[model samples]
Target: MSDDHASSSDTTAATPAPRSLDDALALMRDLRARCEWDRVQTHASLRPYLIEEAHEVDDAIAQGDDAVLRDELGDLFLQVLFHSVVAEERGAFGMQDVAGALIAKMHARHPHLYGDGVKRSWESMKAAKAKRSTLEDGLPAGLPSLHRAHRLQDRAAGVGFDWPDALGPLAKVREEVEEVASLIDPATGAVTNQDALEAELGDLLFAVVNLCRKTGVHGALALDRTNAKFVRRYATMERLAQADGKTLSTLTLDEQDHYWDAVKAEERAG
Candidate 1:
């Protein structure tokens, strides 16, 4: 056969593989129709589980487990199909509609790749589509404070409503610290105005998060690493104390400090 004919013959003889998306959608549809548990579920009912699966995926990524990440991602994808299938039963939209909207959105966002439109910033496109008047309007209210602060700063910065340089945020951090200090009694070292102390402390943390954003560091990830480090050091101290026939609670402050210092020394030696 000629090369073109041979290619065509090969293409015709090849068997088509089943698509995972289609299989998943079929599974969702079947569950929604027959399974009592799935049939009773609604978008509102599955909200918490969707959030949980997303966090599980994040945890899996942090643990550096590809198998767990893949499994968690599959669970997360199932949430999408589940919600779409639920909507389908209510005469709304289905997975195809969800996918089509996403595809359209991505194409619209990347006009340089798909159309004769000029490339524009993602924030600009998002702002144009957003109904809210403020930059921080669309952010979820339940987001962790640090993440919310980071995103809020980012949104504001996108519109040039930000400090000029790293120094600005660093200076802001100092100012916030001073404000927090003012909320405490100078002699007693006790927080006199609890409410004001809370607010000022929040401002200090927000400033630090902004500094993290400007310095190309993720505040949450930095905090997570610090937390892990603390846990490791504390556990080492506990093990050392146990070896010396003592408990951490039984040690004096100075003695505990000695073990803590020892742990730091060991870590540095390693």
Candidate 2:
């Protein structure tokens, strides 16, 4: 039966009741079977759509528009239904099974609520769940190098596998900076040792991210905020330029730098 027909039937029943999750799954299954386009969908073919929908959701979230976010979230959710319906047609578990498994897993993981009644701090909870300490266990291999380095150091430090205090990391970062400076050739006015300098610079950055992590700051979030601040300030400068019947593209680097400084000074003064 069509979803509309099923809804009408349920609503018109003598007894009153809320629609169950299974009812929604049943309607999705019926729609998949009867709709010509839906019947032709395969897992491999739907992968692109799933990815696109997820990115749309991300875009809406980034824009900070709740209304667009709600609609985008619904579209992303349909991807879940589409996948489950396809799986069910192939004799795999349906949406109910998916929901049940996720619910069970969540309950199992949250021991303070559903398992042993022990109060747990976030750090203690993480330490309990972490079961390994090798390089492989430190961080996922696929994260961007900076982010991976941050996570790697944070995980290590959590288990007493780190410097005794903040001073140690601070000293190491200073040492890295000195090494990177030495790798530059002053007489030649060029980098004499690119590899060594690059490695030292990377170490310095990693140490900074680690320090941020240890101090209860997120390196990624801080960098993102800085990026947004720069974008906003630059856009403000662009508007000022447009008001003068000029564009940023027509401005020299020095001219732009002056405008940027003025903008930053104005913010500080305000």
Candidate 3:
């Protein structure tokens, strides 16, 4: 063979072809049939792992690492394949069924792209599919409180039951805060009515979420940023304390506060 042709043949031999979807499905089927561990896993058993993989994908996105995001996405895709294989073994459904349903739903939802119909809001389309009797119906009870609050507000707004503007939500926030404050005894600085306190605090959070919605800020993302900021500042405080020959835990509250202020000032100056 010519030298260039020989080099091309060697490169092809060294690099394996990318696996296809069919290859992935076949691998999952084989694992389910032959691997003792894979054979025993159920949907319920894998719930925690699915949640973890999803969070890892989110973390990868936040880090802006394309390689990590690709790997994390692959892990998530495998979970879907594993569940599909399990269902296939039981003769319930398979990956084909899942893909078919997803395609059908997408086509139905995006009429502007797939059909000769006027475009409608996704929320309206989903509401029709939900056939919910109440505004709050179909919301998962397991959703995080802030997310649930946001969804609840969205549902209410869909039916014209929302504040007209940002000012309304801002005012509502102040009202809820006052309600919460009324439940506490100023002298003792303790909540006088625990149940009322809880309810008022929930109202306050819900009002804040409404304000966030009006301002086009996502409550979860905002909280995540704040949490990251706190972590960074606290870590810096710890490092500063250590540099001064004392651990954070060994220092007095005032000393720790001093370091916290220094960290904040340094961050601000930067």
- Model 2 scores worst on lDDT over the 10 consecutive residues at 4-13
Misplaced by over 4 Å in model 2 are 1-24, 119-147, 150-173, 185-189, 245-252
- lDDT for each residue of candidate 1 in 19-131, tens digit (9 for 90 to 100): 67789889878877777777787789788778887887888788896666666777788788888988888889878899899999999889999977688766666766785
The CA lDDT of each predicted structure is 0.82, 0.72, 0.82
C-alpha TM-score for every candidate: 0.85, 0.70, 0.83
Name the regions of candidate 1 deviating beyond 4 angstroms. Answer: 1-19, 115-119
Task: Write candidate 2's Cα lDDT for 1-270 as tens digits.
Answer: 232321111112243356665675676677787887667777887776776777777667778877677666656676788789899889988887898999986776577898897754443356667666564464545566767877677656666678767777788788888888798876876898788888888888988887777666778767877998999999989987887888888899998887888789879999
lDDT of the structure predicted as candidate 2: 0.72
- Using lDDT as the yardstick, the better of models 2 and 3 is 3
Q: Write down the TM-score for model 2.
A: 0.70
Error of 3 at 7 (Å): 40
Task: State the lDDT at 17 in candidate 1.
Answer: 56
For model 3, the superposed segments whose C-alpha errors exceed 4 Å read 1-17, 185-188, 250-254
Q: Extract clashing residue pairs from model 3.
A: none
Deviation from truth (RMSD, Å), model 1: 10.1
